[model samples]
Target: MTTPNSFLVISALGKDRPGIVNALSKKILDDGCNIADSRMTVLGGEFAILLLVEGQWNTLAKLENALPELEQELDLTIITKRTEERTPSSNLLPYAVDVVAMDHPGIVNHLAEFFSQRSINIEDMMTSSYAAPHTGTPMFAVHMNVGIPSDLHIAGLRDEFMDYCDGLNLDAVLEPVKG
Candidate 1:
């Protein structure tokens, strides 16, 4: 049997623009690397990409070399680090939380602070806003998929969040994440 290859994580950040993916993928392809998984998105005005890749150990140099040109061409930062495989956690349960409120600052910061205090793991989060009809004011919304520890008290967490939300003049909802 063949030995399993190790994986590398690549993270890239730059101004939002086209061709970032094409350039990055071309480099990976040239280096004979395979992408295991990746996440790419435009956050505010910045483009961020995270990729998990696998290939022969020595090909890492080729992968590194492939980035500088793109970095200069696109004015972005690219970083790569190796990762070790670990046994998947079977005990963790995922849940979703949705927050909607009148547009205001610090919504994300406040929510993130709360999660940080509780050591809650956010698997994914997305936030957006749109102009409310006639009012012409923006209405903000946030959706987060989080991993909740089995021992954590959901009711207590909800109460704490509600208190914070009240102070912020926002509507918050927490419910069991249904698959």
Candidate 2:
């Protein structure tokens, strides 16, 4: 019988520069670990990375143990945690949420509170701020993947969500995330 692969979640933050991905990927490869999934981006002046890695237990242990040296070599603050593959819940329906508005504070917090109050889970979210074209007005946008309870009333939820967005003066969409 074969043992199941172990999982590790790694988050790294450091000064933005070229070759960070290359170096990080190379290290994972050399350590006999596979990048199962990752999100990498430059946030302000820092490069942020999140990686889900899979490997044999010993291999993952080696990789985890080497993190200190990797941090020093790459000049990153690296954090690692062992994790297991998620067993998705069948009682949840995947939904995508998009919102755009004039840039202001508390938009994310407000949205989070709304979902939390309804027992909905925000699986993933990405937000950005930019200058609007022509007018150069400051604008903010958010995209989120949420898990809505399957037993919930979709029409009611949509109506309520739209009304909430309208009250906030946010242009928003709530729809299924089609695979």
Candidate 3:
């Protein structure tokens, strides 16, 4: 029988440069591991990458063993952890939340508090700050994928969330995430 596939999460950080992705992906491929999911971006002067890799147990182990050498060669800080495939919850419905407002501290913390108090789970989120057009005023934007419990009252939740956003002077939208 074929060996069962195992999963590994790899995160790397380094000074921003070209060819990092090429080198890393090449190493993964050469070690017989496949990248299942990845997020790569530059923040400030740093390059950051997060990858979920899949392979047979031995193959993953081989990649793990080679990581230290690769880290030195690429001048990156590498971290790895073993994981299992995620089993999504059936009682949750996916929704999207968007917010844009004047750049300020506490926006994310407040949003998290709101969701946390409601027992909602935030699956993925991204936030950015930029200058608004014409005015060059600092502005912040957030996009989040959340899993709301199916039993929650949608209309009530929407009304409450809108009111909450209004109280915070945030422009926001809440809607189901289209598949």
Candidate 4:
């Protein structure tokens, strides 16, 4: 009997600057690996990158070996982990929500706390902020896709979220995720 090989997920974090992507992608290309999916962003002046890479199990050592030099050059922390095969979902219903408010601290933290309490899983999230040109005040926004269990009541959840939003001075809208 033989065990099956698996894909790998790579995540890197460090201060935001130029050439981070170039350095990492060069290493991947030199190792003959392919990037299946990736997301890179600058969050609060720190650069974060998440990548799903596919290659042969025998080549894993090569990929691991290439990281140290890049880490030294970019002053970054790199982590690579094997990915588990995803089981098919039967009762998964997708939900999406948008949140917008005056820029303030603890917004994401508060929303995440609420979601965790309800066992809601966030599949994807994008957050951004900008200054209003006229007033020079900041506006914040978040758009996220979440998974809702079949047992939860949507109306009750909405009401609960509304109360929280009122307290935070934020506006939230929840809707079904459509393809």
Candidate 5:
């Protein structure tokens, strides 16, 4: 039989600071848990953390109980919950999408809504706004990794997406991701 509560997904969000990672890593190690996978980034002045970890039942319980104190001490907001190990699937092919346009509100929402309506899954996305080198015009850019189901037609999809971008005066490209 499988052991109870042996794996967990932990999320911590707070103001960016110097010691967040170190403190969390030290505590996790001290409690005999292994961090299986993690991603951390600073977004809009807030630090966000995501972690997948594995440990024994008591270890999980201890961490669950101990996190609140750490959260309070560090001024962090955290969520921890049990989860099963994930298995990879090959049903979808990876694609890369890049977008460029003058900075404006609703561009991100529109793109995300378009993908959502088409049942496309975005595995990762990064966006930034910066000034153009020569014109000094504010520009927005997005780079995304998407998973497209094998049965979907690529050419028509890209054409439609690009057409939509064209209406917004945005330049966009979608292509198969290279290893």
Candidate 6:
């Protein structure tokens, strides 16, 4: 049995600071809302926040109304929308892809294009640029979690992707992610 509830997916962006999350979480508690799941990170000088908030219908409404004050006070930009809690898919196979190469433009773009052409779904991705270990040359790395349809041929996909990476001068590996 499922209980009746409401969910709000929120994204907030603003200058990084000491108290932004604390303030928001405290306010949510005061408004009788619960934090369902969240990921917060700092990108350069700015902070990015994404969270799913759960509560009853009326309390969720009240929290929504109360947010304008925080937006104005913190000079933050916020976007919120009602959302459904999604269950994980059992029909797709999880695969991990990692790439390392000289920091160059179009690497991520080309990778995205390749996956999009195959109708692949990217679940999550993380990328970073740093100095090479031996030399001081800039290096880029990307790790992504992609969902391949169960009907897709993993061997063919792996072979084609490796060839594509070789053409791009990128070192890449694709392997199944553990359950």
Writing each residue's lDDT as its tens digit, candidate 5 over 1-179 gives: 97644788999999998999999988898888989899899998999999988899789788888899999999999999899877565988899999999999998898998889999998889899999999999999999999898888899899999999999888999999999
TM-score of each: 0.81, 0.98, 0.97, 0.83, 0.88, 0.92
lDDT of 6 by residue, 63-139 (tens): 99989899898889989999987878898899999999999999999899989999899888989999987899999
Candidates in descending TM-score order: 2, 3, 6, 5, 4, 1
True-structure RMSD, every candidate: 2.5, 0.7, 0.9, 2.7, 2.2, 1.6
Q: Candidate 6 versus the native: TM-score?
A: 0.92
Can you list the residue pairs that collide in candidate 3?
none
Over 83-176, each residue of candidate 4 has an lDDT whose tens digit, in order, gives 8656656666688989999999999999898888988888899999998779978999999988888788989988898899889999998889
Clashes of each: 0, 0, 0, 0, 0, 0
**1-179 per-residue lDDT for model 1 (tens digits):** 86576778999999888888998888888888888888888988999999988887767667877777877887988787888765656666677889998898988998888888888878789899988889888899999987777788888878988898888888888777886
Off by over 4 Å in 4: 1-5, 15-18, 73-75
Specify the highest-TM-score model's number.
Answer: 2
**After TM-score superposition, what is the CA distance of residue 169 in candidate 4 from its true location, in Å?**
1.5
Comparing 3 and 4 on TM-score, the stronger one? 3
Relative to the true structure, candidate 2 reaches a TM of 0.98
What tens digits encode model 3's per-residue C-alpha lDDT throughout 1-179? 87778999999999999999999999999999999999998999999999999999999999999999999999999999999988889999999999999999999999999999999999999899999999999999999999999999998999999999999999999999997
Candidate 2 lDDT, tens digit per residue, 79-129? 999999989899999999999999999999989998999999999999999
Q: Which stretches of candidate 5 lie over 4 Å from their true place?
A: 1-5
In candidate 1, the residue pairs with backbone N, CA or C atoms under 3 Å apart (3 or more residues apart, or in different chains) clash, namely none
**Worst window of 10 by summed lDDT in candidate 2:** 19-28
